[model samples]
Target: MDWYPNSDEQLLLRTSARFATGMAPAVSGARWFRDLERGDVQGELTGWPPGPTYQLRSAGDKAARRTGRALLVGIPLVANLIANLGGASGTPLGDVPGRGKPDEPENEVHDFPVMWAAPGSLARTVPWQLDPGRRPEDCVTDLVLTDRRLLFLATRKGSLAKADILGEFARDAVAEVRRMKFSEVNADVRVTFTDGSWVRLSVGNPDNAERLGQVLGGAVRMLAESELSEGQFDRVARFRADLPKTAHPPTYSRLRSGVTLVESRIPVKAGSGLFETHSILMDDSGQPAEPAPGDL
Candidate 1:
């Protein structure tokens, strides 16, 4: 006979599945804020306080607007249906004529409950380094640290309330987290992932960078130390050292029970760098060896 879940058990299963998949639960009265910008906006335009204002909006409303836009744009409906679904001037539906702004000044920096997590899942917002030609101060967002992964929420351009999901780096996905000193006042945190992709975050102050280094580096070390055997760890370190000197350090991942994967970019004879990845098995001593065909 097969077992069936009761209503309560089914709900629990669903909630657990959502949490595991990174789906946020419905939040009531959750205020949304614009991503921090380097400089001030023009006069009284948004009614936000001067000097690093947290532009506020309703999270529920933003999600609703997103749903409506997807339906109107994605569904192939009749012209009349499309017009009915749209806002005045044939613009996207929802919100006032201007960008969606909250009715009251919700600028008080309330603790973002969504960004916070349980004991093992700690999250915080730190300034990140912008890409070339962008202002240094423009990058600030939440960095969520979980026992199994690291995640970040990035705000989209021109949209005050919307955020883009930046990363979901698992414990094994991260290769290294180190601090880089640009100058006496400028310091940055660099996160190298197992896939050879890396990101540099400008934490504004050097002290903040130090704190981030401690927190992030400590998490990585704890995970690696606990999961990898002594011999496997040594092989991972050696694999990192054997990579090309000019390229970024290769990322190491303990893929499964006994398989370890290394990802790197090496210069090819064709002049362009070739991305290379290797999967090896660890013996009883934890030394890396060529994996059997089925092991891969």
Candidate 2:
């Protein structure tokens, strides 16, 4: 019989040659290719068009399937498994309670909490006497800031089931929110309540740490300037805690070139009971040099 090349046969030949030559280095390092080179040709065909060419085509098809599986099936499964294993995970937006749906009526604006527990850790912790049944590892918690309160809710890890109500500090109970440096690029925050209970939390990123400081600092300033009863003022003053002496007030000025400059001070530790100032700059239109998205 005389041999004649069909379109499929001709294209396959071209593709096989191109891929083998172009990917020689990578393919040569593969065990399959090494085995083929070592004369293991029973499972891998030998000869033209039906040999290495066929093997290459089959391998390509398998690689495509593996990539697709990784994207469509493997990733989500692995993520879910990790979350269930008490690795870091966040609640889905849809699952968050009392935050109205798209069509529902909006409540008054409430800022998100500045710092909370990292994923895989307990949301809040109390003395063992307070809750003998709860262990830090078994719970995950979120800190929420509402107009009325700074709330901490602990939930069972891997599920949103309520585990315990850790603490709820009304705005009046907040004594101070201090930014403590942990590293050059990261910080931890401490929230002191009037009752003397305090919580320290890690802020995962520097930007978030700064925003937390700004928002809480601004809130304290606003409260200080507002008209309040003597009792109310004392409560708010607890949250202020000499912030005016430790941190410089934000300032605004216009340059001769018409670019407005806004300056603010951030506190960094100098020594025991001492802090130095770090300057932050922003434009008059309210854009910071380094963008602080949710900061006031």
Best by TM-score: 2
Which residue segments of model 2 deviate by more than 4 Å? 1-136, 183-185, 195-197, 219-296
lDDT of 2: 0.31
TM-score of each: 0.26, 0.30
User: Compared with the true structure, what per-residue lDDT tens digits does model 1 show for residues 9-108?
Assistant: 2100000000000011122222222223212222222322232222333687557755665555322123213222211121112221111222212221
| Candidate 2 per-residue lDDT over residues 229-282, each given as its tens digit | 454335334433534553434323232333322322322332111122222233
Native-vs-model 1 lDDT?
A: 0.34
Residue 49 of candidate 1: its Cα lDDT? Answer: 28
